[model samples]
Target chain A: MSIKQEELEEIYAFAVQLGKDAGAILLERAQERFDGSKQAEQGHIEKVNAVDLVTQTDEDVEAFIKSKITKQYPSHKFIGEETYSRGVSRDYLIDDEPTWCIDPLDGTVNYMHLFPMFCVSIGFIVNGKPVIGVIHAPFLNQLFSSCSGKGAWLNESQKMPLTRNPTPPLPPNAPSGCVFSCEWGKDRRDQPDSNLHRKVESFFNMASEIGGREGKGGMVHGVRSLGSATLDLAYVAMGAFDIWWEGGCWEWDVAAGIAILKEAGGLITTANPPADPATAAIEEVKLGSRLYLAIRPAGPSANETGRQSQERTVREVWRRVRHLDYSRPGV
Target chain B: MSIKQEELEEIYAFAVQLGKDAGAILLERAQERFDGSKQAEQGHIEKVNAVDLVTQTDEDVEAFIKSKITKQYPSHKFIGEETYSRGVSRDYLIDDEPTWCIDPLDGTVNYMHLFPMFCVSIGFIVNGKPVIGVIHAPFLNQLFSSCSGKGAWLNESQKMPLTRNPTPPLPPNAPSGCVFSCEWGKDRRDQPDSNLHRKVESFFNMASEIGGREGKGGMVHGVRSLGSATLDLAYVAMGAFDIWWEGGCWEWDVAAGIAILKEAGGLITTANPPADPATAAIEEVKLGSRLYLAIRPAGPSANETGRQSQERTVREVWRRVRHLDYSRPGV
Candidate 1:
């Protein structure tokens, strides 16, 4: 479904407001924790599973966002990580109504460890497609927002205007160097057909190929794993980092980021076959596709060179990595 | 060989001023290159041999510092990275006089790459030992300083009292985690003994044990190769990371950081056999003794546990790494 420009603007502003509200709550909670862990409390939030974590802060933040959105726009649907985990249907495309997808706290692991890399992400999905996104990182003091057509922006200042050095109608080139973000997901004890190992090896091989043996031949400049998908995508939008790839993250992790990236002249696709946005709905994007690639705009003169370099590096990487049978249920 | 405290203070203040001044200059130069390759006219910085890196900036900064100090007190000695590299004998003996040791730019690689991790390091060595240190990272707006008796500090605030926590230090108990930093250096040719290859393999083995075996206990939290020694040393002081082992870096690369880390109750020794400060003179610290290990603070309660864990891990790492012959001059 095509979203009108005015509708996109409205959604973008709503997403930004929701994100800032959630971000403020997160900041307040983070400040309270600065005095250090206040006694080991055991509750649903603290003791979710044997090892996995879901702090009270996460629940409160997520619930607060849901309530705010519902109160402001009662007809709009909402899906959040915390709510979804508690038996909410994963089917995000149940209706054509605009649904808000949120990850109150992305980089939960970093938050659990007090690593200071977490952020609040809010995405507005219209008819099963994300068209407006906002990501706020209180600690880093950065707010990234994007509407489908109005273009992506950082802190409401710099508009990431698409430029082809000489002016466009020119095919976009691959980035000079790409930065991919990888994370060791929850289930370290469970190895599904060496999926984890293949992912790790693929990262090393791909990085080496792109960066060259010592950063020479590879089309990519370098790679950085900052432990947060939201921040990685934001960095890609800001031109601080060129590309970000990942697997095993939930929709909540990338929904907001995907929208922001798209608006910033960045491309997101399944690492296997390139993603066809026309066919794939936002919520239908699967993690077990086991591959995700985000590429930034290349210069006019070197666009083709950059694309060919990236394609060659990715293919080389795929050839070396053993295919995992993630086709299994619950992998 | 014992120097007067008044003289040391003068040197410390001098170094701090110089570092801040140089860092500001570096930041300005870096900002100028943000839009395009500002250095294209002069060719790549790396194209010049390592020794030639004592550029006009370095020389100018050093001269500015030296002139100020000499004008005030002609008896005081100055030992800067550029000056020492030219002809000054590598000697750290106190000899009853105060000496200022400075690295105008630490993490030159990061500076060249525009990574924003490099810094200016300055230390006042008395009687062959560092008594005062200051490290300034202009871009990050962080200044780390420490006087032997006054305790370490960040930006003249948040004093880092040299107290070891009784609990087991975070490193060893830190589930198989390590971060290593290495430079590609000047030698890029594919040789069996290539330092880059050895460093890379060491990092890989530590992070993911040899042969990709899981239960073998070689896996680490992750590895990071941030190209800055002074910043790496400061990180060790901050407890953000565990161990930072590196080779092929020189005295200028670590001198000031070593002082700061020691003041913060951390440890720095030759990566091989762990040099004892009691016997090793300041001048005895050689570039050839490039193998270095910077370990975070471990308290009495956690000392044994941390030592055992680190010892085992390092030994296991040693088994996988090829022993380098530092006996070869100027490795």
Candidate 2:
């Protein structure tokens, strides 16, 4: 079910080209002002809806990628945000056919704001498992890629090959620092759950704990919400954040990032308990079942400490949340 | 006490050169790692203490600036962070001699972490009032400058022109947005007052008002703490933020920013009272004692709306802040 080394190299090269192409187009279009009135007229107001934002740009890019993949390997399958939005689903059982998942823009909000943080993410799934991934942030001149069994890498730099070298890792029981990234999803005012209050309260509590009374027990360096999922994942890959937790983002928001983290010896899963009982049964034991805990490649013995640190921080954050009801089962 | 156009121009040019020069030096030296052992050996365990962080680099930069100013204009007086750290009083009374106030590194913690949100702030105090200010964020390639009688500018681009050509003034009743920037400061633990906690809580309440938030009220874009006071002020000048409320920062932290904001038709004052009491005694209400409220250029009609928005937001925030003692107050 694993991808061959030669195939990984090919996928990496293809993804790099695709990412650059999309990045170039975005940069060019960003320089000019679109007719604000036209945008307002074109149903852009519905963009805040969790399920309604599939812009023409998204479809065009997905179509472009599909065409390229079909021409090169007609038998391969494709999974994309636009296609998924249209109710496409695939059985991710171990298989020989390669499955390509793509998110044309990981930070759509940032792109809309012209904030320069969005990026192209591509992942290769083989035998129902992600085996390779590539993410490109062209404006920032950063490219990250990795393949299963091979160490991850940044741009073509080998100095700090995405793998951790043998070094004494910080103790797991040791206090940890964290940077949590969250987005203000569209439904701030009228939602059934009203997750906004809970999210904000959690952020405040965690920040206060780390910056404790005179910042004593506050072992955290700081918390940052850069408003980009791709950049947040990349930061985890770079050891800039100890943990990244989130809920409600779609699979497209995380598919490629999951691959990147895995190849870098990280983990990922659903933030909430799975609706499917089978998935939940297995998730209870494996760290990977929990939503995106990308512990940077620590020394072999340091993994325990990293895991403990992550658990402690999350627990402390949960305790300090004041206004929200966290007792509604598991999320 | 007002500076002439020509003098302002000369000061602006000098400031630009010095800022760029110091920025370049900082970038070069920042790559070298300091001996952690030495820092620990200095008995400077006040790791989170605001005052105990007087590194040699700060002194070196201050000395460099002082010497440069003294050599270029022997009559000008110099005020800097390092000198002020050595037991200087906060009084900045007016004097016949021109005065320069400088903060070598505005976001020292960020600098220590290799984060790119720090800057060099240089301001000119003329007769006890800020007349010219230049804030350079070399890493981000941003430069904000302004002179008395002239408008504020960003990276040579005229953002708020000194002389308004015929556009309607900003509406007085326009709702205002704010960006509250602050640090945890040195006292994370015990103190007579938890000013930071109160300030942050207040900001949250104002930004995210409770139920029935009306008339574009409680609809702040979001809060951003980029870890640099100079950058925060620059953003205010650029209209990126409607209000910037901060505490625990010193004169050096804000001197340059005050000049820039003034030039941009903004206001500044302590966040204690509704009006500057010192200025209340003055015949000219416009020339009241300064505290720190850098407002954007608003049309005559806009003043009422702006004031209303400010008061409502501030009061709402004060209502939510519980930990701090706000009994003693004066803006």
Candidate 3:
């Protein structure tokens, strides 16, 4: 039986509240140990061991969120950050049953360092497709939420499609005009010649009018590495960033973001676009396959010309940074 | 005669409030034009023209801050972002007298995009020395301030030196373990093998476990490019970021940050270490020479070993990405 639209809406509301609650607990824990105001006398022993407390906080928040959600939706399946970190395979769990994909704390590294760029990310998937998502950033006091067909919102007032009139594709002689976002995840397996090293090179190329290592210039204005995949995707959905290239994050990191991005009319594909578009399936998007490219949606009311401009911008980006792709070979 | 300590304190308070007031006006102007919420129907012509409004906010806030500060300290020299952007050399302005260096809006790109990483930065210099600095981030509702000899602060409550217990030096053969921050300024003079291209290559190398183009690996835990220099410095002073390497920004971008960094015990050296540190004068910091390296302060109560550890961390970082220096060739 197809789940009714109203039921998805109810689930969306429930997950949003659950995200906010989980965010609160993490926020309190972070604030208590956030800085070194009083540690002026402590030694390296204290510095080296700080991550332990932070690890516990992560586990606590995940446990709290899991208990609350499982209690409410007793039959629902749950995949959380800590659980996945403990060696669970996140790719094969989705099915016809309702699965709550959650990143109880999406930017753990940033949190341990006291940088305020983390959030609680939650997405509800039904029949292997994301139908709802909610992300709460307590430090910034911003909530981004969406349900399929209901539209996405930021802090309940600002709707998505942050820009309908994004700058048209760059003049061929000129550089692309868009803010880009990417990251260097914890899994830095290969060294000087690895795909990551190349990806980081591409990021620098995009930010510069200057050519990269091989002397090819990307010229895409600037770049941002905010250290949060979920927030990076959310910002693209809100149009703060024109595009976000992601890798290495699990299903929990991108699931909730996919729901919000879909509701906002954004598009996602493999990090490297296919030579033949017919082979790509939007429905078969792999949340943990380790390579993704996301582009901002055209404004909801954008004319056909505006939509074409948006696509042209994406095409230019793909051409310039396609060599940065590392996902396919490994897969 | 040397200015009295109490008088310096008063000036610090005055500048802090002025920074916040200017920040508030800019914040309000930004919110009014932040996104394309109701603007989805607008065309590229309109989107391209939006920068015109953003430019107005930048100049308007600068004028507002300059006018207010000039009225209060009519005899003091003043340098603002807009005036400097109009081709005034920021150097040679610091004679023996008092002069206010201000960036009415730092991170204009972020402001234009409605990203919350912008701020107002103001620093008071006396006898060619930064005596007082105040950086106010209105969106974050944070004020970081400092006067000579007095400690820096966040919101005037939490003291600076965000972490008294910094990570010890990298053990031999270990990666440079720290969170790093850098920026991509908009000056693209030469393409295909420019200094920036080399600099970006260095950044990628720092993030990798494998060595850089020159066979050096920084092995930093991660990197952040939040797009705001003033806030970047403030965060460094607050200990959130372990090191910040900046080039191409004006004096207005870093003077306030310099004062706070000094008060917090943080240190600033050129992006490239001087060939002879013995000949360098802390007094001749060259605020607008356009390259800087900021490191969090060692603890006030730490032993000699702690100080040595801090120095070692800096040494490792310097070895990793020091090719990013764009100042000397221009200096």
Best by TM-score: 3
Candidate 3: lDDT of A311?
Answer: 54
The C-alpha local distance difference test score for the whole of candidate 2 amounts to 0.55
Q: Report the lDDT of model 2 for residue B308.
A: 40
Predicted model with the maximum lDDT:
3
Ranking by TM-score: 3, 1, 2
- Candidate 2 CAPRI classification by DockQ: incorrect
Considering TM-score, which of the candidate structures 2 and 3 is the better prediction for this target?
3
Runs in model 2 deviating more than 4 A are: A34-43, A48-100, A106-194, A209-219, A256-290, A293-331, B1-3, B33-59, B88-97, B127-132, B141-193, B206-219, B239-243, B258-331
Candidate 1 per-residue lDDT, tens place, A120-188, comes to 999888766678889998755678898887778877875542222321211222222233345444323
lDDT of 2 by residue, B52-131 (tens): 35555666777888888889878788878878767535454336568898998786655544445568899988767778
Question: For candidate 3, what is the DockQ-based docking class?
Answer: acceptable
Query: Largest DockQ belongs to which candidate?
Result: 3
DockQ of 2: 0.15
- Per-residue alpha-carbon lDDT of model 3 for A236-302, expressed as tens digits? 7876777787766667889999899878877776666556433333333566566677777653223
Clashing pairs in 3: A36-B162
Residue by residue across B27-71, what tens digits does model 1's lDDT show?
777655544545211343432333123345566666776776678
TM-score of 1: 0.74
Model 1 alpha-carbon miss at residue A49, Å: 10
Task: Pick out the ten consecutive residues of candidate 3 chain B with the lowest summed lDDT.
Answer: B44-53
